[model samples]
Target: MKNEIRVIGGRFRSRKLRFPDAPGLRPTPDRVRETLFNWLRNDIEGARCLDLYAGSGALGFEAASRGASKVVQVEQDAAVCRALERNRALLNAEAVEIVQVEVRRFLAGEGQPFDLVFLDPPFRQGLVVPCCGALEENGWLSSSAKIYLEAEREFRLDGLPLNWRPLRGGKAGEVGYHLCERTFFR
Candidate 1:
């Protein structure tokens, strides 16, 4: 079976993207995305972005539609990657790149700093801390980057980098979303 999600803002607003139904594949909801982008209005234009665990490529595509210079979507699943590719073609998203690799493996390679990152790993996998650490330690973030995190409402931000200052947060039912800014780098 396949599921569909809509891009809620930017040039691709109202476009429908289809994806295969897979375990742990949850696309960020429309309202949540709207709020996140609103919070990033001043920062997103022409920014470089990384979308880890890119499941349905919702956030990444939205960023591209909104004028991000480049958007890398990292997904471990081949089927999902194919769907993302199709969507990229459908939207003529020249700035979006789909990387078919595990998030950690991708993060382990030489890093290119990104101005914004979306880290929405599978729920209940305890991946947030390690991935967050890899992103910082591996130098995948620009000095003043902003990161968007989505997880279960009960999930805490303990163990995250001390410089990741929370800028905004909100909740919708079982999910909690936050935007954090990476402060001065050593």
Candidate 2:
């Protein structure tokens, strides 16, 4: 069976996007998304975004809906990629691009700097830290970029980049969500 998620705010508010029931595919809950967007309200418009491990493309699509100039969604699963493409077409999201590739591979290649990033890798796979590092080291993040991360509630924040300061964070049941800002000290 397929599942659906709605865009909470912006031009596509209330529109629903469908996703396949693939293993390890957990979309960010609406409440958490609302809070994350609120934290980013001042910075989201016209920002370039990267949704790493874009399982359901919820975060990426939401960014586009809220006026992000560019949003790149990277997913490794073929089925999920198809679903994301369908959603993009359904919404006529010309600013949103769906890339079918592993998050690591996508990060390895050079890319334009992003003003915002969403990092919500699969639970229990230990992909978050390395992905954060790659974003920082591989030139994916612009200076002072904002990153939103979701993980198991018990996950620690010690692995995050040293320059990334926690701007806001909280837990919802088993999920931990955080919004961080990169502080360049040079």
Candidate 3:
């Protein structure tokens, strides 16, 4: 199995995390994360983020490490939430908020929009498109929001909304990733 890496440019560059054992929770790989953050470098600083399916809080912590002002992490699993909390504490990530709740309910309850959002739900649950729709429907995304998605390589949605342009996409190992930005998300 491959290993995870800390943020390339951040406060916690080499800290280690005891992320979930793979085959159960699939964390985004270091290389893919590096590329994603590179693409997001300009937007991430001081941005508010929403991290759904926040296993291990890797992406959320990375956001905080890279200077995101606030990050809200939503996870349904209790164990994962506890681990995420611990990881955040380890990194002194006061800016990271941990919410132990299902992604759907969380979206339905959101009162604020985010600047950056990361969606890395489990492969088979099929939560990405619906989540995006919910965000759009509830104004949980700013007019200029950006979303980074990672899914099983073969995954595809039937009717992805056209609010954003598909800026970049590719397969990182077995995961197909998407990075898109909103143009007129009204």
Candidate 4:
């Protein structure tokens, strides 16, 4: 199916992004994205972001549009990666980078710490916890960095990183979205 998702705010407000009909590649809904960005308004400008499991480039592009200095989008599907590249070119999004690699492999490699991260892997694949762990253990996150995680509504937060503190979260139909802060203890 040919489907498109829109950017709800910032420089690219109302921009439509098209994605291939790939299985389990649901983009975060517009309303949810609006809320997520609202939660991130204060911290987003000039921040570095990582969009793990970036299915449709929704969150990554939104972050870039809203003034993020750098946004890295990681997706394993070549087709999706191509689409992401197209979107990046369309927007002349110099700050957005696409990495066509599995999330696991990308996390295993070295990377700079990000101020914000979006994790919306496929539902029911048991990826959230491990991805969160990889971001923490692999030094992909900065201190007190904000992380936005989307999953099945029933998914639990107990498995997330110990230093992560839930800041804002709610369920939207079958989807659950949350904003957490990575805390640092003295």
My TM-score estimates for the predictions, one after another, are: 0.98, 0.97, 0.93, 0.97
TM-score of 2: 0.97
Question: Could you give candidate 1's per-residue lDDT for residues 1-186 as a string of tens digits?
Answer: 349999988999899999988889988988899999999999989999999999999999999999999999999999999999999999999999999999999999999999999999999899999999999999999999999999998988889999999999989988899999999895
| Candidate that beats the other on lDDT, 1 or 3, i.e. the better one | 1
Runs in model 1 with CA error above 4 Å?
none
Q: Which candidate is the best by lDDT?
A: 1
Candidate 2 overall Cα lDDT vs. reference?
0.91
Model 4 spans with C-alpha error above 4 angstroms: none
1-186 per-residue lDDT for model 4 (tens digits): 458988888898888888898889998988898889988999999999999999999999999999999999999999999999999999899999999999999999986799999999999999999999988988899987999999999998988888999999999999999999999832
Candidate 2 shows a clash count of 0
By descending lDDT, how would the candidates be arranged?
1, 4, 2, 3
Q: Please identify model 2 stretches exceeding 4 Å from their true place.
A: none
lDDT of 2 by residue, 66-136 (tens): 99999999999999999999999999999999899999999999967999999999898898899999898
- Candidate 4 or 1, higher lDDT: 1
The candidate with the higher TM-score, 3 or 4, is 4
As for model 2, its CA RMSD to the true structure in angstroms is: 1.2
Local distance difference test, each candidate? 0.94, 0.91, 0.83, 0.92
Give the number of colliding residue pairs in candidate 3. Answer: 0
Clashes of each: 0, 0, 0, 0
lDDT of 3 by residue, 38-137 (tens): 8998998899999988886778888999999999998988877878888888888899999988889988974598999999988977788888888888
